[model samples]
Target: MSGQPNRKFDLALTGRRGGNVWTIDGEPYPDANPLSVQPGDHVRVHMVNHSPVVHPMHLHGHFFQVGDAVQDTVLVPQHMGEVTFDFIADNPGDWLFHCHNLYHLDAGMARVITYVQ
Candidate 1:
């Protein structure tokens, strides 16, 4: 879309009894999917909920606009809600992105997106 490369990616958040688990690129995240990016690249995160409960996604250090929230947290309803977020990989470093629920993070529903040199 913009000057940066427009890449489409989908992440799934599955709800469990107490928390949720996340998957990226068809693999279990954190231990499996390590986000890789380059400077100027535009990434579109299409977060889909596969579980029966709602999940609020959050990204640290970067402010994203999904609807109107200036902060990072966004509410995604169960099994049907999907949030589309775009960001320019200008900051070259590793940034954490995941569900806002602390229990979800403990349940492996978190990941780090890295912008390379």
Candidate 2:
């Protein structure tokens, strides 16, 4: 956990009513832009939830500091204006970041964080 981030990302979480689709920053999983970082970079993510359901966002391979706590998963309440967190990119690999809700995950609410040399 660090006070300043070398890179930052702003994401909007949304879902289509009655449709089997979910999106992040207007793009569905496998299509969402990959978050790229160097191994030592400090990263920050700002998320806004527009859907009507809570989204427990999970990140694999890294734990982020939210306020005073560190966690791998954070609950983004429905209609929340924003939530932000930061993490150090110590792991050098492609990692998954997604909504933990199974249906949402299956519906394409996911993206990848890639660490590059």
The per-candidate count of clashes, in order, stands at 0, 0
User: Which numbered prediction scores highest in lDDT against the true structure?
Assistant: 2
How big is the positional error of residue 21 in model 2, measured in Å on the Cα after superposition?
0.8
| Residues 1-117, model 2: lDDT tens digits | 546788999999998567699989879888778989998898999999998888899999999999999999999989765789999999899999999988898899999999888
RMSD of 2: 1.2
TM-score versus the correct structure, for each prediction: 0.80, 0.94
Native-referenced Cα lDDT, model 2: 0.90
Maximum-TM-score candidate: 2
Q: What TM-score does structure 1 among the candidates reach?
A: 0.80
- Residue 58 lDDT in model 1? 82
